[model samples]
Target: MARKMLIDGEVAAVADGGHYDYDLFVIGAGSGGVRGSRTAASFGAKVAICELPFHPISSEWLGGHGGTCVIRGCVPKKILVYGASFRGEFEDSKNFGWEINGDINFNWKTLLENKTKEIVRLNGVYQRILTSAGVTMIEGAGSLVDAHTVEVSQPDGSKQRYTAKHILIATGSRAQRVNIPGKDLAITSDEALSLEELPKRAVILGGGYIAVEFASIWRGMGAEVDLFYRRDLPLRFVINFRESLLLLIL
Candidate 1:
């Protein structure tokens, strides 16, 4: 039996009767999966999506709605970009001869609060977009039970089985969150986006965009910053010529 759902002012149905089949089944709610599902739904296909449980780190079994990119990666990273961009704005303000006051201290809490609020708001908007598109948003981790069949472990510990004409997986990549002493204490970009305070000193530990952006942000806000990258050269515009000429997954 297919379910019935409404999108925008129109209506789309997945199962109007009993247990129903879907034209498309999506695993993970990242940008690609959701976008594909929505586009398919818009074309009058019955679509369903399964999202894993939420965690600071993303994985097939321990992911959340909006996938890694939304909950932990792209969204958070872009927010940091927005935060870092304020420095340029302030510089421009100075160039415009808007010299006004005393020492301007950085307030990390304000941006953090607003970031949290915006993420929540975007999450809701994502949900609404799916619902309005008549796409089924399943909350759980999906597994390939058999050919053409997918089994989902829901948040409440229940299991659901679905058969679909097509299945899409778009979980996106996870950060290389390391494990070591105080590793758990270290903040990923997810938390960095909502930092409570701009530390007087910061030691960045990766060659990734998140690390570099934080370095820029903290330094811009008058914090001492030490950036450490594994490679001899920084990631930006660096090229290497190695002897090995072959690398293929297949």
Candidate 2:
């Protein structure tokens, strides 16, 4: 007589109904998680998303709502790149019949401060977007308790558990330093983005997009950069623009 349904490959009775706390529980508040939660919530499903508190530098338990791309990765990197590119622009302006006065100085501190303010503003924007979509936002690190349950570890050392019909994990990724001598002394991209002072000279490792981007960013800002990679050439896999990219790096 009671309704029957399949959950986790087992037949379960749905006669009681309204058993779970939410229709959906998202484990991360990154771009992907936020989008997914919003879309689901728009469809009238009760949704909840949990993420760590806001911080520029990410850890296992300190990522912001906008996630890596907005908080520390792409958005911040592009801002620095634009700030650095001004030096070249100023020089090129001379060719365009523009007379420049005294010495043009780049202040790393000012750029860093403004970049952080923009990131913080974007983080809040993402939170508001989620709220507007009728999604519940929880501040904490989320872990899976079971197939349909999530346990969030709050910042104040409190744990809250919730049940949902479905769970999604979009925790994103973090930067990892290579294992070598003085590895501890080396900083990852996370710390690099929020440095107190800009390095007069920088030594970068690897040949990936991030490595090359940083090298260019620092070089544009008037830093002495030495890039080292164990490859025949940087961006070897980028067959299309490899030649042009190589020239840019050099």
Q: What local distance difference test score does each model get?
A: 0.70, 0.87
Best by TM-score: 2
What is the C-alpha lDDT profile of model 1 across 140-190, one tens digit per residue?
Answer: 878887655789886577898988756777767665558767887777666
- Model 1, position 181, has a per-residue lDDT of 79
Off by over 4 Å in 1: 1-20, 53-65, 87-95, 179-185, 236-250
Candidate 2, poorest ten consecutive residues by summed lDDT: 1-10
- Best candidate, lDDT-wise? 2
- Give the Å error, residue 212, model 2: 0.7
State the RMSD for candidate 2: 4.2
Candidate 2, residues 1-250: lDDT per residue as tens digits?
1011122322222336647787789988888999999887776677899999999999877999999999999999999999988989999999999999998877899999999999999999999999999999998999999988899997678999988777889998899989899999899999989999989999998888899899989999888999899977877779668787667758
